[model samples]
Target chain A: MTANRPLILLTNDDGIHAEGIRYLTIAMEHVGEYWVVAPEAEQSAVGHSITLYDPIKAHEISKNGSFYGYGISGTPADSVKLAIHSLLPRVPDLVISGINNGANVGINVLYSGTVSAATEAAILGVPAMAVSLAQKKNPPFQWVVPHVERLALWLLKFGLPPGVALNVNIPAIPPEALRGYKLTRQRLAKMRESFEEREDPRGNRYYWLSGEVPIEESDDSLDATALNDGFVSITPLFYDLTAHSHLQDLATALKNLT
Target chain B: MTANRPLILLTNDDGIHAEGIRYLTIAMEHVGEYWVVAPEAEQSAVGHSITLYDPIKAHEISKNGSFYGYGISGTPADSVKLAIHSLLPRVPDLVISGINNGANVGINVLYSGTVSAATEAAILGVPAMAVSLAQKKNPPFQWVVPHVERLALWLLKFGLPPGVALNVNIPAIPPEALRGYKLTRQRLAKMRESFEEREDPRGNRYYWLSGEVPIEESDDSLDATALNDGFVSITPLFYDLTAHSHLQDLATALKNLT
Candidate 1:
């Protein structure tokens, strides 16, 4: 690790104008030479998606010394890809996504555009982290910025593994009131899905996709549990989705399918 | 599995108007009751993304008896979610996506909307399959329909595991001349990314993302290799994404970070 300032690529699932990304940008400004390339619209739940079908439009919003910001017409993953492949001076020393509006814990991480942005960077061999606040409604982010800055500094000092990125969810509490961080695992929480079937003014039928996340916490000290218990959680996430434990069983079961 | 006719949900990334989905619908018409709900426009490389920010519009496009279709204004994953949660009579006996325009083999699967639809269904505990052709241009799909029907029938008879899906890549050769199916694994060949920097007529600088997929055959029996060898390839894919092999090593390395 170098004592010189690290080049950090910052992004989020929320649009560039969101309070979450703004707070994150403020936090990261003092730590390193940073570039922000985020989506123009809120892209929550866009899991690992990249823009391929349409031409992406990137507008430069800021270009000062050691700092740059561009709002992209794509997803979080697209922002990271565009930054790395075109916009940046070089491959960034680290990629940090979010300071997201809500906690991306348990199976939620699978659906998180914030985490997916970080994962995209990690897949290309850059160190990365995805940070989120454990609240659905926007929380006051000023107090959490310092903690995020500190964590980012620590991660820069001690680099992450090549294909691993940290999924960090901080409790929405004051710094003094918050408990310390814990390395945790992902839990399986059921996202109860429901639909609101309605008719448009034209008398045609339509449905609104809506779901409620179960607030029930399990006994394990997983990411969700830590957030529910008022502690900041950091879960290491990877991109290789192979279930090695089931490989042998699958091999046996699929033997006859051939 | 029941001896009765299977209930199948058919979808694709090539929108409702593409010939690929039309051919796929014809193939599955005999296998079971078919419910087709696909994106209204091309959603090709939109990996595992779902629509949350916008109101989803689903319009019924087919009126054939026991054959229903919907045109959804969402990604491939969103189509599947809408089908399972609200549109279908019950959970589908099997979920099949594509007959997509190009091959979704190797690392290309990570960015494929076709495979992500199947992955979403698999994560929800449905038996799923994602089928694609190894051709960039649209080939005569009439010959491929019979082979797809056979594969679908086979899957309906022998169900897949809870969280796994078969990514089937078919050779574009005529069905009569093509070799038989081969059970294979995902190849490691990645699309080499190259940025084509361009200037708009209005004098704004932007980039058009372009990349070429190198056809280096990693193994003779891998998914990409099988398609290159004139055979259909069926690779079982899972969604866990945890690199369990490196978990212990990662834990040790992460412990040192503190």
Candidate 2:
């Protein structure tokens, strides 16, 4: 635990071979001593799920001609858990999940494997952040690499409070054209989703989950809006699911139940 | 859309054929019209995941020579999404997820497919509650059926606040020996986990995620403690992951990051 050279654990929901983490590892190399531990396959939308009731296999992954990190047959949460508890030589000072393939904003935060990995790290008493490039497909990871490096360095200097992790989203645009960062809240705008119905070869009716129909939003202080307007979005997130605001009212209402 | 006959959508993470869901259906039948749409395979701890890239297939399932409901090859979240958006007769009056075999308390709520299914419904503007019998194996759903019925009747009369879902955990005790229900907050106790290492037929080492070491906790109001002491724990939860308390401090700390 050298104060000068912090141990930064690197992970992603995308498979170990994904371009995002590869670029992120290259970026974090300058920030601190980076150790990579991530899923063996793409684990998008897996949330905080862990592999229980089954055996998980972790293999040492290598890139080019050298060792990369460990690739585990588990969810993003599993990767972080395994890395912190069993793999890392010592506890990491900071954990960075992603440089994800797509922006994780709005309700996506609850369903995202990228953010979940960071959440796991935070729960395990580490300063963590989940970063995402706004592009859904074929994102320019190099353009955003410096931005991630800058933010991660800042994060290493200014540690996250206990039980908190940052959900960061960068706009998918040329760095020259991009605006600066903005502190934002996760969007609560109504999103409508429908499924795509199809018949497989066996005459069975199947449905593929479709995209969200983005409802109109009048609020500009939300993460979704900030990303669309060419700003990097940083929303501090925590894992506590309790509706603290509704606690009193809920107690009063449910008192009549029994 | 009659108010008296509430249309209740039933689902679980333990798959459609799990005894928990079967008992849940029977319990809901007395409350209102019950429609069962659930995953064909066990999806415990899947969290709020929905299958996006994969095609989801659904088939009509019948129990006791009668049409039971639809079974889908999807997650608990996917089942709820498909049911509300496409499959159901109308928007369900309420969605009750579980009669799950295990408790969803503290951090488990974030990783529980049962709680996540209810959470998905709450997001889609429906009153929802996830019911878990705090028994890990062979949970007797019979004792808790009447209690669930009473709770459902109460919920029908007094609707939940918007953006809120209830995570209900009943103790795994007998009806007479059980202590009364208590409104509880999600536990924040620390848990230590270790993985068991084993070798497969091919001499490949694999690890199975093991149970948590329950650090001694003194907080009686937390869901985990309440459940342990033979009390039903109802924690109101929301999907917004923002660390509202830390937002101001975080904003001030990162102001110099740029």
lDDT of 2: 0.88
CAPRI-style class, candidate 1: acceptable
Instruction: List the lowest-lDDT window of 10 residues for candidate 1 chain B.
Output: B241-250
Worst 10 residues of 2 chain A by lDDT: A211-220
Give the poorly placed runs of model 1, Cα more than 4 Å off: A1-3, A63-68, A215-221, B63-68, B176-179, B187-190, B214-217, B220-222, B256-258
CA displacement after TM-score superposition, residue B78 of candidate 1 (Å): 1.6
Query: If you superpose only chain B onto the true chain B, what TM-score does each candidate give?
Result: 0.94, 0.96
**Model 2 spans with C-alpha error above 4 angstroms:** none
- Candidate 2: give its CA RMSD in angstroms: 1.4
Kindly report the fnat of each predicted structure, to 2 decimals.
0.42, 0.79
RMSD of each: 2.8, 1.4
Residue B196: error of model 2 in Å?
2.2
TM of each candidate vs. truth = 0.91, 0.97
lDDT of 2 by residue, B1-258 (tens): 365699999999999999998888778877999999999999998988988778888999998999998898989998999999989989998899998998888887888999999999999989899999988878989988987788888878888889788999998898898888888888865577877778889988788777686666769879999999999898888888988888788878878887
The candidate that achieves the highest lDDT relative to the unseen native structure = 2
Candidate 1 local lDDT, A1-258, one digit each (tens): 456778898999888878887788799878998888999888898888877766788887763553458999888988998899889988898898987877888666777899999988887778898998877685778867987788788788777766778888888887778877767777754467766788889988777777656557776457788888887777777675544455566557655555
